[model samples]
Each structure stands twice: as C-alpha cells, then as structure tokens.
Target: MMTIERLREEINKIDEEILSLLNSRASCARQIGELKQKNSLVTYHPAREKEIYRQLLATNHGPLSYDTICAIYTEIISACRGIESPLKIAYLGPEATFTHMAARRKFGSSVEFVPVASIADVFAEVEKKRADYGVVPIENSTEGVITHTLDMFIESNLTICAEILLEISQCLLSNSSLEEIRLVYSHSHAFAQVRGWLKSNLPTTKCIEVSSTAEASRRAAMEQDSAAVGSELAAQVYHLNIMAKGIEDRVDNYTRFLIIGHSMVGRSENDKTSIMFSVKDRVGALHSMLSPFNKHNVNLTKIESRPSKDTIWEYIFFIDMNGHIEDDNVKEAIDELRESCLYLKVLGSYPVAG
Candidate 1:
C-alpha cells in the first residue's frame, strides 16, 4: 500500500500534468480557430463535435462513465469556444427562465447569452446569424408538445444540433402570507401544468396570465396580494418568498429543450433524427410515409402534426426517430418517406444523451 504522503505527491504531479496538457490543448485550439477564421468557417460545428465525443467514448476505459467523459469534453470544447468567438446563444427569456437555465447548463456561463422576448425571436436570431445557437422548449412530459416550437421547426431552416432535458420543479412565490394572497399569476402553460395543484391549494385565488413566467414572478414581487407559480429559479432571481414548494401537479415533470442551429451534424453511435413532412391528402398517405421506418426497422419515437401555415386544413407532420440520418437504414427510410410525402425535410440528426 502507498503511504498518504506518497499519494499526495502523486496527486500533485497528476494535477500539474493535467494543467500542462490543458494549456497545450488550448493553444492548439486557438491555432485551429485562427485557421477557421481565415477560411471564414463557422465555429459551431456540430458534426465535428459529435465525432470527437464518439471517438472519446469509444476509447474510454474503466473508472469513468461515458456521461462523465462527455461532460469533461463538453467543458473542454466550451473553453476552446472563446478561441474563435464567445458563442452567442439565444433563448426565450428575461433571464432566469427555464430556457435560459437549459442554455447555461449546456454551454456553461462562459458563452454570451442573448435573451429574447419570444421563441420566434430566438429562432430568428439563429437564422439571421446573430447567434451561434438558439435554445427553445420542444416538449414537456406533463403538458405535451410546445406547438409553437414544432411549428418553427416546420417553417425554419434551423437544425436541431443538441438537446437538454431539464427536470422541472415549480413553486408558489409571493411577498405576503398564503392566506393574504388573492391572485395568482403565471404563463398559461405553467398554469395549465399545475392546474390540479392550484385547485387543491389556492382554489379561491384568481389566476392571471402573463407573457412569461418571469413576468409573472415580477408581478408577484410587485404586488403583495399576488403570487406566481413558476420555477424556483424565478423566485430566487426576483427576490420572492416561496409560499409553497414542489407545487407541480406531477413529480415526474420534465421539459426537453432543443438546440437549433444552421446545419445538420454527423451522427453518433446513439443518435436521434428529426424530420418534417407533409403527406398527400389521400388514403394511406400517412401510413405509406411511416411504412419505410417499419421496413427499415427504425424506431419511431414521436410523431406530431401542426397546421401548415401556408394552406388551410393542410398539415405538416414532425417525426423523431432512433438512429442518425447517416445510417444506411435511416437514409433508406428517408428516401422512401420522400417518395410517399408531398414534402419532406430532415431537420437534423444529433447524438442522444447517454
């Protein structure tokens, strides 16, 4: 057995080695960034990132899980981001919003954050090249799909580069006593999600809708008799008291966020592909579109429809499936799907989290 003194000396040496290697890596990344800038190449290369993580995980040995390895590399990449330019990420916000939280969780606080008033604006910022990426809520386990985000996917040219799943916990925030509160405020979705809880706890309080949960928290902070049903982050940011905690109607509530950018990335061993398509207005059109997946043995995870903004009664179907677009089976399925649908677009194929 090694002595404690010897172990301490070994650990110090390891720490010094890690610091030296990281410094060298950062210098090399800076040089690469300069070359990319000279070639006018964009900094957010999702495909390259996926490839790097895939190779890293493949070579990983015992003592660390795949997620731990990926997380360490994520920070390495984030630190190298400044070698090009501080990545500007757009999110639906006034700051302290869940979207903002997701963005920070994914990219870290080093990247510059641009909070927009609406989801549409977040997409627009990415499309217009004002931001490197946009983070937006795609779906919630309790409340179903966020239709606006799905519609934007159908309408925009953005690709889903990465995804983040956030476990949601909401609280009732106020400045006054629970009995003194006569009104509650929250975004419509948040209210809908916690309707059951509200009925049980504050049945008599009048519910008011606001632009965003952050706004609701702001209103709650300003009005003594009003409370906001929002994330705990909101309460902390707005300096409000938590009247009640864990107030969500369901404990398993989680929201999935999508990172949207300009291009599709290469696939990983574990990946999920998203596509938007419109079936012909004929019998079996939808079935024919999906038949390819069955034939190819591709797993279809989700399918949702939205009204096609261009025409009345026409609809666009969004699909999420296991496997990356580069897989032979996935590519074949897309080819067959294209033949069946009037229109089809592969939104993106990105690595699924471990």
Candidate 2:
C-alpha cells in the first residue's frame, strides 16, 4: 500500500537535513578549535574524545550496532578535528602492524600515519614533535609486557595520553600453498604468540625472526616457500594469499597499546593513573609505597617493577590505579606515597580503555 515515490521523497528530505546538521556541527567544532588555538592548547584532547564516545554510546538506540555508531563518529570527529588541525601520528611499523592498527582505531583514517622502525623510534617521534603523537605496544595478553616499551618510558618525557586494547588474531600469509611453506617468518613476539600452532602444524619449517610482522610479510611475499604470521592487513598490503586465518595458538589473544604525546590528557569520568617510583631496597618498602592507594580507597589495577638499570637489584615500581590524578583521594594517596619513595614520577592519567 506504500508508494515508493513517497519513501524516496522522505529519504531525500532526510539527506538534506543530515547535511545541514553536519555542517552546523563542523562550524561549532571549528569555533572550538579557534578558542583552543587562542588559549595555546593542544588540539587533540583524548579525554574529551573519550567523553564524546561515552555520551554517544549511552544515548544510542539502534538498528546500527555500537561498533557501527562508533565508526561513524570516529571519522566525523577526525574530519572536524582536522579542520582545527590535522594530526600526524607515528606507530611501530613497516605498516600493518598491530600498533598501527591500534593507532588507526583511535585517530581514524583521516589523519596521517607515519611508520617508525622500533618502539624507541615511536617514542622519539613524539618527543621531538616530528609526530604529534605516537602509538606503541606496551603489553600482550599472551606473551606479557614489551620490556622495550617499558624501558622507553623510563627515559622519554612523553606522557601516556591514552591506551588502546586490540583483539589480536594472526593470519598465515603466503604466495603459495600450504605444502610450499618451507620456512616461517614473523616478529619474535608474533612467533611467541603462535608457537604452539607452528610446532603442531609446521614443525619441520624453519622459523625466522623479523623486525615486525609487517616486515615478515614483506619477506614472505618475495621469498619462495616462505610464509608470514601477521595481520590480515599485511596480506592485503602485500597482495599475498591468506592461507590460514586466526593461526595464533591462543584464540583469546589481546594486546594493549599506549598513545604517547608531549602533553598529558586531562581528567575523564572514568580514568586510570600510572606512576613509577623507586623505594629503598629493604623489607616492607614496597608495601609502604602501595599503602596510600589502599588508604585512599583506590583500586590498584596493575603493578610492575623493572630494575632501575643504575644499581644492582634496585627497581622502580609502576602502578595503575582506578581514578584520575586530579581526584582528591588519588592526589592525597600519591602525595602520601612520595614520602616513602626515593624518586616518584607520574607517568600519566588518561581515560581507561572502554
């Protein structure tokens, strides 16, 4: 009983309304950008960005899924943010690496992505301001912490602006058939992730380490009888066939990446604070440092200790707690901690990964 012309007419009207509303939003964003510029403020605000997503998700009632809604807004924000200033980001790369994927997930496809060779390089790019920000892998749910990233934090003055949690699924990519894969190539981390699968299926294949998964794909694409363990993005980039998908030993693998920048993120509704400090090498010393977090009623989400690299057995502890650095209880707790620690550094306070 419904007329197609009537439906088409309604859709046309809706399209005009959508365009008008988008322009209005862009105008407002540009005005905000002018104010930020006048105030000498950084154009990219991860805390405000997180709040935008949170508010949108809370209001969304859909035929569209949560991911779909997020994707729509990500590009919209990215485009409008570009009008204020286009962001240039560095990531651990040859391109198509998980860190690269995480960077894209946060900033969207509208901005520039620069691929650097090492975790240190990623840090350097942000520190030198060659790149506005950088994304580096910090830890994997499967293989544990990236010590290099942790080490970089010890020296680099950059703050952790945000964190990204990516669900990692590797693919076996090759130009030839399974029978032809005589050698396996992957980053050392990637090999660790899918070691059991390689041992079970291609035990006879000689495995080699590369700088990154993307680098492995590059080698595999050129070398005969070689396959790469990498993201599906790598397969597409190199025009290689994905002989097997989700080839990792563990299916539930996840990796956490950190966004590093010169400026720290402001407080968000839900936040996590990370800090590093060294305590006297004595009994109950570590306990004395952590006591304030308990006294302040803060929940400690993560804690890690790395050797100070200056003296034997001397170490600095890194703690991530639930709450912003600006929060009264968190500030009181950290100040209390300062008395016990020989040296203290607030690494960052950012919105917790949703």
Candidate 3:
C-alpha cells in the first residue's frame, strides 16, 4: 500500500509536470498570436473556444465533475490568451452586477474589464474601438427581453460573437441583522423576482429601487440598518455580510448576455444565427415572412418584436435561428425571407452557449 507521504510526493510531481506543460502551451499561443496579428485576424475566437471545450469534455472520464474541469481550463485558456493579446472587455457597470459576472464567465479574469453606466455605453466602447468587445444583457428567462439592448442593436453595427447564460442567484447583504434591517435596496427587476421572499421575511422593510444590484450593495454598505438584494460577489466587493442567500423567488431564474464585437464568429459544431427584419406594409406580411423558414426546414429558436422607432406602430422583428449563415438551409431561408421584408440584417452567426 502507498504511504501518505509518497502520495503527496506523487501529486507534487504531477503539479510540476502541469506547470511545465502550461508554459509550453503559452509559448505556442504566442506564436499563433503573432501569426494572427501578421494576417490581421482577431485574437479571440468563440468557435475555437467552443471546440476546445467540446473536445475536452468529450474525452473526460473524470473523478471531478465536468463543471470543475471546464472552470480549470477556462482560467488556463484565459491566461494563455492574455499572453498572446491582452483584451479589454466592456460591460454594464459598477462591477459585481449580473452583466459583470456574465462578462467574467465568458472572458475569464485575465482580461481588463471596463464597467460602463448603461448598455448603450457598452456598445459605444466597442464601436469606438476603446474596448475589444462588449458584454450586455439581451434577455432574461423570467422578465422576457431587455428592450434597450435590443434597441441598441438596431442602430449599432456590432455583431454578436457569443452568448452567455448565467444563472441568477440573488442574495441579501447587509452589516446589520435581519431584525435590525429597516430598509432594502435593489434593482426593480431584482425586487420583482424576490417579491414573495421579501414580503414574508421583511414585510415592513421599504424596498428602494436602484440602477443595479452592485449599486444597491454600495448603498446598503454605506447606510445603517439597510440591506441589499444582490449577488454573492457584490457582498464580497462591498464588504457586507450575506444575511440571506438564494433569495430569488424562482429557482429557474437565468439571464442571457451577448458578447458584441466587430469580428464575426465562424461556424462551430452547434451554431446559432440572429437576424433582424421589418415586414412590408401588407396583410399577412408577418406570417408570410416566417413561412420561408418552415419551408426551408430551418429552425427558429426565438422571435421578438420591438417598435421600429422609425415609424409609429411599425415593429421590427428579431429572430434567433438554429444554424450558421453559411449553411445552405439558413442561406436559403434568409433569401426567401427578404422577399417579404422591407429591410433585413444578419446580425451574426456564433457558437451556441453550452
């Protein structure tokens, strides 16, 4: 039988081997980066990242969970990518918000994160080349869509390079005890999600609406007898105690965020395409616009409508479809779709979030 001392020695040897391999990988990444820069190619590739994850996960027969392996590789990949090219990512701001969390999850901690005040600012950062990419919330499972984010896409020329699905776990953070808490601060959407829990736990506490959960945490940290409903990260950033955790009323709450950049992502094994269009002024035009996808056997994952803002009562339709724009079925479907629409735009084709 192996002794404890021997097992530790073996583990240390394996750790050294890992360190050596990581350094080799970093060297290779730097070479690739140089080639990409010489060729004028983008540093980040969503399809390649997805391919790496897929290949690793497929071969994994592990003592650790898939999530654990992915988390470990995420940091390693981030570090290697940083050695190649240091990236600056813009996100909806005052860090510790859900958008910030989503941005971190997508790009990892190696990148510089710039937190802007609004979704439009995130777009501006990327559009002006101040940031390499931008992350913004596009929709929520419980709250439908972020109309402002959708609206920004109509005017901005940025493409959706990737999507991130973040499970939202709201927490109550404060310096005071539950009994001593007299006020609560949170975003309006957050308050709506945890309404039932707050009603039962702190009925008399007045809930003040703020721009974001991080801001709420900041306010709670400064004010006496006040608590904030936010993320665990916010609690750490603001130095507040987690008075209550998993406080959201629903268990399945999730928010989807989009990574916007100038570079268009190439097709992956599993790809999704997003498009925006406006139907012509004719009865059955909207219905006719969707018929092509069914006719071409193309799958549409989601469809949403927002006011054209160009014309009153005229709506612009956004659709998320199942394949890359390069695919035959998708190409055919869009070709047919344009006949019924006054305007159409292919936002991007990217790897679907796992």
Every candidate's lDDT = 0.87, 0.90, 0.94
What does candidate 2 score on TM? 0.95
lDDT of 1 at 266: 67
Candidate 3's displacement at residue 100, Å, is 0.7
Considering every candidate listed, which one attains the maximal TM-score?
3
Rank the models by TM-score, top first. Answer: 3, 2, 1
Better of 1 and 3 by TM-score: 3
Q: List the residue pairs that clash in candidate 1.
A: none
Candidate 3 per-residue lDDT over residues 165-209, each given as its tens digit: 999999999999999999999999899899999999999999999
Q: What tens-digit string does per-residue lDDT give for candidate 1 at 1-354?
A: 999999999999999999999889889889888898999887777657768877887898958988788778878888887766779999999877889888876886668999999999999999999998999999999889999999888779898998888888888999999889999999888898789999988889999998888899999999879999888889899999988888888888899999999877766668899999997677777887788999999999999999987878788999999999889999999998898678999999987843
Q: Over the stretch 49-115, how does candidate 2's per-residue lDDT look in tens digits? A: 9989989889999989889999899889998998888899999998898888898889998899999
Best by lDDT: 3
Task: Please report how far candidate 1 places residue 143 from its true position, in Å.
Answer: 1.0
State TM-scores per candidate. Answer: 0.86, 0.95, 0.99
- Show model 3 residue runs off by greater than 4 Å: none
lDDT ranking, best first: 3, 2, 1
